[model samples]
Target chain A: MSAVLRVQDLSVAFHTRGGVVRALDRVGFSLGAGETMALVGESGSGKSVTAYAIMGLLEAAGRVTGGQAWLGETDLLAADLSRIRGRRVAMIFQNPRAALNPIRAVGAQIADVLRRHGGASRFNAGARAIEALRAVGIPDPARRAKAYPFELSGGMCQRVMIAIAVAANPELLIADEPTTGLDVTTQAVVMDLIQAMAARTGMATILITHDLALAAERAQRIAVMHAGHVVEEADTATLLAQPRHPYTARLIAATPTAAGSLDDLQSVPGGLPDLRRDDTPPCRYAARCERRLASCDGALSVRALAPGHQVACTNPLEAAA
Target chain B: MRAILLRLVGAIPTLFGVVLVTFLLTRVLPGDTATYFAGPTASPESIAQIRTSLGLDRPLPEQFWRYLVDLGHGDLGMSLTTGQPVKTELVNRLPASAELTLCGLLLAIGIAVPLGVLAAVRQGSLIDHACRVVATAGVSLPVFFTGLLLVYVFYFLLGWSPAPLGRLDAFASAPKQHTGFYLVDTLWAGDFETFRAAAAQIILPAGTLALFALAPIARITRASMLAVLGSEFIRTARASGLSGPTVVLTYALRNALLPVVTVLGMVFSFLLGANVLVEKVFAWPGIGSYAIEALIASDYAPVQGFVLTMAVLYVLLNLAIDLVNRAIDPRARRGA
Candidate 1:
């Protein structure tokens, strides 16, 4: 299947008084129509940065040094920000309460996006906004539409945000830790809503998260990132069964699941390398790898281990024959 | 709506406290109005008669009681200096002060709000630097000095402004007092020439006051806009495919305006206080100058009346601000 969205060699840096922090380095991934790809990593691992960079929503200090994010025929990075942001691609932020405009009514906020990008007529925008809200499983959507963000619960606010992100039914949706601060029960519901929406619309989705088990459960494909580099990418089952990169193995071992008890989990040692350093290594996880080889110091590249399975390391684990 | 009512009811005690304080403070001042009116050279017998007639011979409690009764009846008593009723003086002069204050406020808001938004949008750029310089200069200079400097430049150096005198040219006849505001009164009289003269005369004092008012308005706008611009909602707005202008004005500015409106209310009260110096410099016949004159002459009634009026105005102004704030921010309306 052709990619609905293809991001290739995306590199970003933040310029600050201390130094230029290399945020993302040659990060590349692609998602086919209606496919859900989870980009999993620890906090500050450039997962959110990659999402923001793709949506052209990076903060003032951040700059896309080199990249091409193609959504259909248009390169999103080079495209006019307004053209592709909501019409073609939409984002669901982590903190819905903060992301939703505080002073505006939730209904008005949804209607704004619908009118602007969904081609909803001004006269019918309110009805369409309520319809969008109801689509996200919000009960009494008409009454709730008149409420402000502060007036709603966290879960409801997130639902409003989801309604806004999916209002235009864009071809691609990027959810940046959409369930980060929510309770477990609400997390399940929100995730279910996103999955259901993506399936219903046949829209591509890039779900960025730190939960390995969640990625395994919800995403069709998984990409493991460590210190701004995609360490491994494969089908979710293949990545979970036999993670080639050492970091990916550690992550899988660390994630506690219904089948695996807490005692079975093993935490990875060492912290992420500071990206601000002048001599930052190409293989960011080489220092933490137990199977480190002297050749790991050289330029690392994504080597295909099998069809549709790639790992970026000089010495990747070989599958047992 | 209930919150507004509560605030209004709550202001009763605050106004009472102001009344008590102003009454006590003016009475305790070094010179007594009776003695000042009697003159330093008057004989003791004549002084005693003057004091008796002015009711200074009455007990302090009884005097205060009578003062309260008169105040309740809307009689602010007679000004010992001007011999006019203090209430009448305030009524006539209040419009002048309101006109100047309103004009200055309009100028300040018109210039500062846009300038602040631009400064915040292009933070760290040359325009931001320029705004910073302007705000700093506005805050650094005293109002009197700024007024004088403006007079020296526009009136003396450039010859663009009217003379630094009262509301109209010295020889111009006073227009019929309909609204008591010269601008309104002249327009009411259908005398465009007098209106032009009044408008020109106000430009210098109002402009001077506007500079004083501009600094805080601009700074608050910049800081508030900067904060809102950095908020997640602004990102959401931008991500929603809004054009740059819509994102700034509709989303950022609307949210930013809450805090700026709060500061604007405070600035309005501050400008009213600052008007004393501006009035003195420009020789504009406003309540501020009247209060200062009464203050210097130790006229008890006008000073008391002026303070009471200002206190009431402050309470009313705060109420207006609360209403405006609630109108703009529904969260505030809901007390959320």
Candidate 2:
């Protein structure tokens, strides 16, 4: 499959009262048309930053220092994204209730997005909005659309959020911890709905979350992020069978699975390195990697073990594992 | 409608409290109402007769009972100074104060809301600094001082405005009293000349009140807008690819206005209190100055009636605010 979205050498920094914090450094990834890629990372791993930077939704304090994010032929980082943001690329945020406007009706909110990007007229936007709500499996879309976000349950709000994100049938949907605040069952349902929508529209998805099990179950490719770097990327099965990067292995070890007991889970050791420091190492995860070598201190780069699998570490777990 | 009815019913006790307090406070004043009504050189027998005739010689408790009974019958008693019923006195002067207060509030909103929104949108910029200076100047300057300064500049120095006199000049006849507001009444009577004179006479005082009212409205709007702009939904709005204006105005401003509506209610109450000084400076025949004059003369009825009227107007204003809030925010409706 051809690449529908490509991000290369993306860097982001936030100016704060204390100092400048470099959040992302040279992070890069690509998604094919209709592909589902999961960006799995711990807190402060810059997964959401990458998504926001690509969407041009970063806060005023944050700046994209270096990067190129290409959506098809257009360079998203350099291009005027106002026209393309909701038309070609859309986002679903965490805490669906907060993501939706509190004062507006759910249907009117959807109609706002549709009218802005979908060429829906004022006369038909209401009906089309209800139709969009119905498409996301919201029961009684006509009545529920008139309801406000506070009136809906968490799961129902997530469905409304999905309805809004896909209102224009954008080519790329970025789901940033979309199911974070939802219940476990609702999480599964929401993820399934997102998958179904992506499949129906042939839309690519980049799911940003730290839940490795959900990523494994829903995504075709998994990219493991450490600190601010994309430390590993591979097909889900291959990555799980043999996680070449030590950080990826530890992340998998940490995740709770259906078959794994509480004792079977092994937590990833050490916290993320402080990116605010001036003398930080080139390899952000080297401090925590048990396999760290002297060579890890040198310039770090991604080396492919197979056609689809890449790892950034100097030392890797044996393939025989 | 039911909510409004409930709210009105709930306001009864508050109104009663205000009436009781006003009655007790007026009773504590140094001079007696009957004594004030009777001339100073009047014979002692006539003063005593006047006290008895006016029911002031009765025991305090019986007097309060009679007062409450009279209030129940919507009889506010008679104004000692005007020798007219306090109800009629209030009815006659209320529209003038109402007109001035409403005009001031409208002007303040027209200028302050947009300035606040602009300051919040370009926060820390030159326009924001300018807004801060304007708000600071507005608040720091006293209302009467601003009123006098405007009179000095517009009326005395420039001759651009009519004298800082009452609502209409001596030359202009009173417009046919449709609404009691000179501007409205003049228009209703198709009396454009009197309307122009009324508008000119009002501009300085109204502008003074507007300047004082603008500070709080602008500050609250800017603060509320800043908070709403930072919320997650605002980012969602931007990510939706709506135009910048729509995102700021429709999404952010709508949410921001909830706090502003609340502040507007508070500012309206403050402006009502601020009106007495403004009315005195302009010589406008409004109920505020009427209350002050009655208080000085120890005319118990008009003072008590003025406080009661103000309390009732405040209650009605709060009800209007609640309705407006319900319209703007569905969550408020749910809470109601």
Candidate 3:
């Protein structure tokens, strides 16, 4: 399938009093029709930053220094705020509790999206809002539409957020930590709802999260990020069975699998390199790599491990290749 | 509901605060009504007789007790200047003040809310910046100045003066004065021309008070709205395909109103208290000017009545604010 949303070399940066923080450095990824791609990373690893850039929801302080988010023919980064805000791209945020308006009813929030993009009148818009709520498997959608955000559970609120993001039927949906704050069961249900909706609508989704196991199960492809770079990208099965980059191997080993004990599950050592200094290298994961060769310091570039899988490093760990 | 009750209970202190300050402040303002009324050179015996009869010779506590007891019976005290009962004076003047305050508050809210909302929606933009300048000017300039400016515009420039200065027209002789308000009285006069003229005269004063009120309320409203707009829910609402107004009205402005409601109560009480100056500026015979004349004449009844009424007004305004707060935030009701 053609790429529903193609993000090419999108790098976001923050200029501060201290120095420029290269939050996202030449990070590239894409989402195709009905496919789920998880951008997994730790906090401050440019996971949420990349999602914000994709959805065009970056705060005033941050800027998309170099990038383009394509929604069909429209370039979202270049689109006017009013045009992009309601119609083309939609986003679901972390902390479902804070993501919804407390004063407004959930159904009304969904209907709001529909009304703005669907050209529905007040009556029809509300009907469609209820329909969107029902689509996300919310029971008694009409009655539930009148209920305030606080009245509902966290799971319900996140579902409401999903319903809102999907209501306009945008080709691209950026689910930014859609289940971060939710309980385990609620997380499963939310992920299922997101996947089901994406599949039904044939919309591309970039699910930014920190949960590797969940990403493994839900994502068609997983883009493992380290510091501010996409260190490895591949189909989930291939990446899991034969991980290439050292960071990706460390991440898989770090996953809390029932097959491994605490001693076997080792975390990657050392902290991420600070990108403030001018000497910061293209290979951000080089500091944490076990097999750091002399040639590793050269301009690290992407080398294809497979037809569709790419790894960004001068030296790959022996086990993954 | 419990919070509302608690708020009502708290109102006692507010009422006491109003009466105490009004009473004490008027007393200590370096002017004595007894001396003002008796004149610079009067017989000591006549002064003593006047003091005793006026209950001034009684102990301070006894005097305060008498004032409260009379107040409970709805007797504010008589205006020494007019020989009218203080209750009668309040009853007579209340409608005019109420009319002016009500209109002024409505006018203030009408202007302030929209202006504040517009400024908030487009913060740092031209409309927002211009309104900021206007609000600063509105708040910085005194009510007296605003009233004078309005008079200059309406009376001097436009030649559209209100029926003299008083609330009622001198010619109405007021066929029916049940409402105690001039507009109501004029309506009862069955004379639209007189009513229209009375309303016209009332408008300038009311409008002046409103503009003075508008400044702070606008500034507060804009600040509150800016904060709400910055909240995550507003961002969520926008991302949900909601229009600017929908997100603002449903998500942003409704939440912002919590602070605005509080200020509204204060503004209501403030406008009532400030009406005295406003009435004087407009040359209208409202409670403010009445209190001054009564204070000078040692008309203890009317002054006490005015202070007591002002106290009650302040307390009641707080109560209204509590109820409004409970109504807007569902969580507050649960907490209560």
| Interface RMSD score of each model | 0.9, 0.7, 1.9
**RMSD of every prediction:** 1.6, 1.3, 3.6
Name the better of 1 and 3 by DockQ: 1
DockQ of 2: 0.83
Residue range B1-336, candidate 3, lDDT tens digits: 566678678777777676666666655666555656677897787778778888778877787777778766766666767877777767667777888888899898998898899898877789788777878787787888888888888888888775346765565455366677767766777767767777777888898888778877998899999998888887787666576677778788899999999889878877887788888888787777888777766566677678778877777777777778878877666566
Per-residue lDDT of A68-124 in model 3, one digit per residue for the tens? 777767787887756565566788888887888776677777777777887778889
lDDT of 1 by residue, B1-336 (tens): 677789889999998898889988988988877778989899889989999998889988898889999989999999988889999999989998999999999999999999999999999999899889989998999999999999999999999998989899976788998777888889998999999999999999999999999999999999999999999999888887877888899899999999999998899999999998999999989999999999999998999999999999999999998889989999777773
lDDT of 1 by residue, A1-321 (tens): 789998889999999988999999999988899999999999989999998898888888999999788998888888787877887898988889999989899999999999888888999999999999999999999999999999898899999998998888899998988998999999999999999999999999999999998889899999999999999999999999988899999998899989878999999999999999989987999888899998999998999899889999999887755
TM-score per candidate, chains pooled? 0.97, 0.98, 0.87
The lDDT values for all models are 0.91, 0.92, 0.80
Error of 1 at B140 (Å): 1.0
State which docking tier applies to candidate 2: high
lDDT accuracy of residue B151 in candidate 3 = 84
- What stretches of model 1 exceed 4 Å from their correct place? B170-178, B185-191
Clash totals in order? 0, 0, 5
CAPRI-style class, candidate 3: medium
The per-model DockQ list reads 0.80, 0.83, 0.54
Model 1 lDDT, residue A149, Cα:
92
